[model samples]
Target chain A: MATLTELTPKLAPMEPVPFVVRSIRDELSDTFTLELDPPDGVFEFLPGQFTMLYVFGIGEVPISVSGDPAQPSTLVQTIRGVGAVTYALRQVRPGDVVGVRGPFGTEWPLAEADGHDIVFVAGGIGLAPLRPAIYSVLANRQRYGKVVLLYGARSPSDMLFTQELLEWGGRYDVDVLITVDNADRQWRGAVGVVTKLVRRAPFDPHDTVAMVCGPEVMMRFSAQELEGRGVPQHRIHLSMERNMKCGIGLCGHCQFGGRFVCWQGPVFSYDELAPLLLVKEV
Target chain B: MPETLVLDRSGLASILSELRARDYLLVGPTIQQEAIGYGPIDSLDDLPQGWTNVQSPGASHLERRDDERLFGYVVGPHSWKKYLMPNEVVIWRGERTDTGFETVPPEPAPAYALFGVRPCEVAAIAVQDAVFMPTDRVYRERREAAFIVAVNCTQAGANCFCTSMGTGPAVGEDAVFDIAFTEVDRNGTLAYLVEAGSDDGAAVLQTVVGAEPASDADLAMLESVLQEAAASVTKTMDTDGIHDLMLANLRNGYWEDVGGRCLACTNCTMVCPTCFCNTVEDTMTLDGTTAERTRKWDSCFSIDFSYIHGGPLRMTPEARYRQWLTHKLATWFDQYGTSGCVGCGRCITWCPVGIDLTAEVAALRRVDARQGLSVPLPEVMA
Candidate 1:
């Protein structure tokens, strides 16, 4: 038998600090993005990581950081008014305080994909979560090869980060392909599922790392399409979504098979998640 | 034989007095509404003496024993979790300040003396520790201050399978406990063979009167009694490759069969000492000023357990059952270094429809023999 060792007492698990909302911009009728100022002029987080946004007496919801990693003074998150908590977040005014507990979960693997071409597949509001990764790649553009972003939405109006997409489109280094399921009268871009653009998208599949974020069905098919084009399954990454009640793994709501989506991943390689994704209604 | 103390029935009363004088809240089993339930007790007379619980799948009742042996019952609906983790607790409380909402420091956990904790329950507490410790200070504070007194089972219940789970009959060598006792019931006369696993436990016993050091004969008698208890457990869960067996057969139709009978009532999880799944909810006053973030025990059996923005991932009742079962038997080993189930059989005896997981596993193995099981692709892909 060995002598027992003493461990330091664990701090309180759930601690929410107040962050003042600097601005709120409506991306669509039901969606909005919030810019918050932390007490200290810094709140650092990896790309693809999320925070538990608490709206005072309302509730909390897991929202990913859509801001640039370089900017620590301002914490940014995009959310849809799908539930009570999110709706309360949308109603918050600038200067109003909201609670935040995070910078949790696995981040996008930009370092692993440094020298390889990066292909981003984003659908509707899913683009918000992938925006930070896009910013990171663009900032270190010289380290990476060809960069392509294929974004899809229900309609042209449902698209998020439209202004940012236009700027990325103008860039000579990045190829931004936009698609809508249903075209409006003024729309002129590709009108189909994002997976359709996977065919015409110019990137070397053998030397490319694909980052996908979207509804489950879209991600499954996008990864399938990427795999068909010779991109290794392990190189294709996805940001998973489950009921993440607690950003910590203590709440069992975010379990996707053996993995806790809040902890082990919101980002997992296609190869690692292939078997789990295959299991129906799990 | 290790140094042990022999405490007759009178000594048991003295032990209770000593614990009370130490200001420790004694939580032990007592007769409650025709069933033995864990509650606060002061004296030996408060124990469910001369009473035994007859537990089967979805059934349990109190029956008077011929001998007045304390700790006669196997287990009941109430587990020690009610005291430690609790059913509902306000982990965080906040009030609206002029700046914003600020959290109020929570009150400290109560000091508890868990009296007559079964060996299987001792294992269950250890399982929960692996699940909650190092991260959840809310549950840790309660667990760290609590003292456990484990009692060995002299007889196994009808639903008992702790022997098969390797967590029972006699407490496992690695099981956590402060003190352990094996009751020797000889024709209605009761004597406890007590041994301290901690210095604090020994110090407490040192103060009790009429405590005599045990002899070699008493130690041998204790060993045979434990052996008898193990042999009596007819119900067994064969754990050979259970992890892979469960994870591989996610679409087993046996789940559909169990789903038909299981009411999704959440009784099993409530009784399961190791089922630590919970959900946090926020409650505010009518004025919408002060708010509390409360953590409540939740069951995977519920339809809303896996709900996201769109809907619940597991809409089908059979899918929920599969999630609960697979998570318990297979993924638990992956999450914690040990199996989630201590095999106390509380889940079996307390289940509304008697959905025995041991039998469910047997059914899955039986059905799997046919091969070519249908594991349909995701609804969208299909």
Candidate 2:
């Protein structure tokens, strides 16, 4: 393994190093995935961490890592062009040089749930942040128990990594269920909220560990449904989203209550966050 | 070993000159726009002497005192953060190159000698130290290089509550300082009791002429003055179980009541010494060739502070107020294992509506106690 110093020598936490866009793949109409190659070394990060992507003349925004962690040199980030910075990032072509800082924040608790049944839940473009975790689980398939993935999107065209999802579902050991809010004429999958699929998914609620990522409201309801199925609050983990300006936690835009989501978590268990989440507008 | 000495009022000039000779920019409280604020102090003439501050909720003014005392007034709107962390700092500037872009990190800060630092301010700096010292390169370098000349407060303002917070009125033994001084009125003559906390402080004092070793009587006078100052504090806070109290009453109506009156102008947060929230911005040159990323002080009161893709987490004024208070008194204990507030009372004095945190806490406790007593027991349990 290359040391951090060798990866980006003499770089400050806030400093952004140059990375060239190797390729850009359109995931959805609004979202695209970028594969980047650093000037010096690979950007090594764990599953469920994010990077602060900077466009040359525009600004910087936090985008989650959406690639396999094993290949640390290949920097991959999936972005939805919602804001100004992201919009500029979406227009980038291959060979364009952009500044990249981090691969920061808390990682998914994949290793901690070694023997336990794993349930991965995602909503809309939220699946982008969970792709790395899914890859980690698939690579180390024998280390865990039953693995289930439930994904929900707005429409058929909105589904990300469609080919990979199908391949994962084809595996005899995995269960993949995809849902859409509103289905088109050709759609054949279930059409309802993602949480509804939880009732039919085969897993022992007591023994399973669930990781959820999506909109705030969706995550809240999903957590509720998981709890209703007898899953302990601590066993249900969810990734939180906040305006992250400084990925190092100093900028303070990502504070959720007392915890800086940039540092302490973007992934937190339901038990640790229940009290703060219960309070309105925390 | 800590050594004590006596320096008459006339000796302050020599101290300033010594620090100036050492290439340290001297900063102290000075008369500025009817208030005593921290600014560049070239000599003793700039220090706010014979002028004490009168502070109440939402208001503060400088008035003439009967006797001459350099450090009589408590803290003003300005804090050490303006010097250390700064309001605006360019973290790095990037220039476009043929390959990509070359970035330049910010320059290191100059050495500073902060004169007239009170004990509470020291505690505030320490709280910020725990925060920025670990992660912030700029703050750590500037704070580590600072030469602190702490002044033990002999007078407490109307809003002062450092005693309740156990942070001030006197520089405690455990407090970190280069030099600590307590102004004593002996037979109506102003004399400063000086103590060296570090070896550098002792070396500086060695250069002073006609300085006498403090006798037991002088030490006795200093003790009585500090005790009187501590007893004179008008505001108090019950910090026991304050974290739990705030958490339990997060949804209480008191927040709504206070929020209704709060303009969310962010005065309290801006004036607070420990509120370290900030935001970053990128500014490009006219030609768009070079860009600089600057970090500025930010307040949680603003709706944009917590903004995400959908909307801001805190939309209402009440929620922002709760966030500020809860983080200061409660969640901060959970985050850093110490209260964020150093009890400097700047928030109370600088607040547009004069919102007193101590009063708010007291009110919440009263309401919480009342609610607990009013709850009826279950018939089966009874």
Candidate 3:
């Protein structure tokens, strides 16, 4: 049990490296996207992984990587100014410094879904975490069978990456369906919950892998609708959200049942989380 | 390899002095305020001599024993976690600079010799080792530098259930103790049969002046003392199928009944040696030029412990209590490959409302049996 007598002589796991804000783009009324420049000119991360962004005098919060994996040097994070740390982060301008740690947690299993049809279901800011996965699928377009994306937002103004969604919809090999809970007279897209779009999306249920990320209730309903259609529970994946203090597995805040969301996953198969999800306050 | 020697009760001071000579801080049980707790002990006078503890649900009292014995009590309110894992630790500090912020890591921990550690506490330390060693550098550093001098219990407290937990009364075979001692009553005199389990322990034993090799009769007396201690345990918990039983009863109504009485004060988790959950707090200087990130002990009973973007996951006492117990007894096995409870009875004794986990588990099983509901085991995944 006494494996090592001395502490590992290295940087502490919680220590954050310095990163400069190269650019900040406001996506919505309260949300902004910041592109960071790492000290080494490189910051690599998977599609579903998140980074702990720390403001100088404020605290840290976990935000998912929203950029393309191929262009790993320019780290992009989309954050909603909901809390103190995030609000502080939203105020940062270009040339300011911020602390960055990780790109931690499991990635969306895009490789495993290689020869299968892929359906992406994202609600609100949930699309930011799934953007990298969409990039991976599009870059290797020939490797997959069919690609479909169903996105829902609170209102037409709340939708993210509108231009990219339009371009992807114009692609001959892809299908994109956009929906909103409330829309104005100018909005011509569907108006309903994301689950309604799940029924309209075209793909072989048996051969398709569904990746859903949204509010807990939205994901739960979307997973149910997918399962009701012929997709196996194990083939469905969902990215879970929990209060995370430590990006590593040390802090117990992100624990969901026996597994830590920071370690075992922020992304887990529907079958794996079904039992725990059924239990209230779990 | 194992070696046994005999030392009179008077020679215990030599062991303390030898450890201090090696620059290892000695921590042992002592009388503080009104109860016993582990603290710095420089000499034999600091020990809780002739003291015995009486423990019950929600109550604990210390009284004088008939004879003057240093290791007379089974355990105290404090476990070894305070010294090893610690209550609060500053992980790193960052200072604002001209270009960017520069962070400074915390210093390494000092060497420590935990004196008078009971067998159950040793097992508790081992349990924590499995949980933290792989992922926690701070805990690993402190634990690696610790020298454990375990004491095999000669008596069991009223609330103790280590005999049922399979962790106490006698030190486990695989326990990593530098030195172990078992107090035996030889006729009218008291002696400690010292066993050295490591080279460091043997080096300290050589410095003692009045120690001698133990005879066969001495070993027999030690065996009888341990056997008596094991038989004296008044509380017992049935661990057979406990993991499956608790998992099946996640939605059990008994949790609400227990939660109605529970104050959610977090006493049980605070005293529990194996509960290693913590929360991090960032404190900034008034000038806003520097900030420090510190980790402190946290409990699942706190609603904020499970808070996320919207609100807390555990909003009710029933949910919090269920989470604590299920994680301690059932889910811990799945996560760490061992039971989290060491059965030291601190949780039962220190709980404000006297909530006994053992009794609750029994009630859960009885209700399931009466209902005759067949529960299938949950699918295990990493």
Q: What Cα-based lDDT does every candidate model obtain? A: 0.87, 0.85, 0.87
Candidate 2 local lDDT, B1-382, one digit each (tens): 4778899876757788889998999999998888888999999889988999999999998889987788778999999888878889887789998878888656778789999999998888877776777677777778778888999999899998999999989887767778889988877888888988777777888877778888988888888999999989989999988988888776666677678788999999898989999988888899878999888999999989988888888888888998899999988887777899989999999999988999988877877734672223223212
1 or 3, which is superior by TM-score? 1
Candidate 1 Cα errors over 4 Å, as ranges: A1-12, B186-188, B369-382
Interface RMSD of each: 2.9, 8.6, 4.7
Q: Compared with the true structure, what per-residue lDDT tens digits does model 2 show for residues A33-79?
A: 99999777778899889888998768899889999998888999988
Residues B1-382 of candidate 3 have per-residue lDDT tens digits of 3768898866767998899999999999999878889999988789988999999999999999999888888777899999888888887689988877988766878789999999999889888887777667788778878888999999999889999999989888877788899988877888889988777888988898899888989888888989999999999999998888888787666677777888999999889988888987888899989998887999999989998888888888888888888888888899888999989999999998899988988877886733665233223111
Instruction: Choose 1 or 2, whichever is better by DockQ.
Output: 1
Sort the candidates on lDDT, descending order.
Answer: 3, 1, 2
Give the 10-residue window scoring lowest on summed lDDT in candidate 2 chain B. Answer: B373-382
Q: Tell the DockQ for candidate 3.
A: 0.50
DockQ of each two-chain model: 0.57, 0.43, 0.50
Clashing pairs in 3: none
**Candidate 1 local accuracy as lDDT?**
0.87
Reference-based TM-score, model 1:
0.97
Q: Which stretches of candidate 2 lie over 4 Å from their true place?
A: A1-12, B369-382
* TM-score, model 3 to reference: 0.96
User: Which candidate has the highest DockQ of all?
Assistant: 1
Worst 10 residues of 2 chain A by lDDT: A1-10
RMSD of 2: 4.7
Best by TM-score: 1
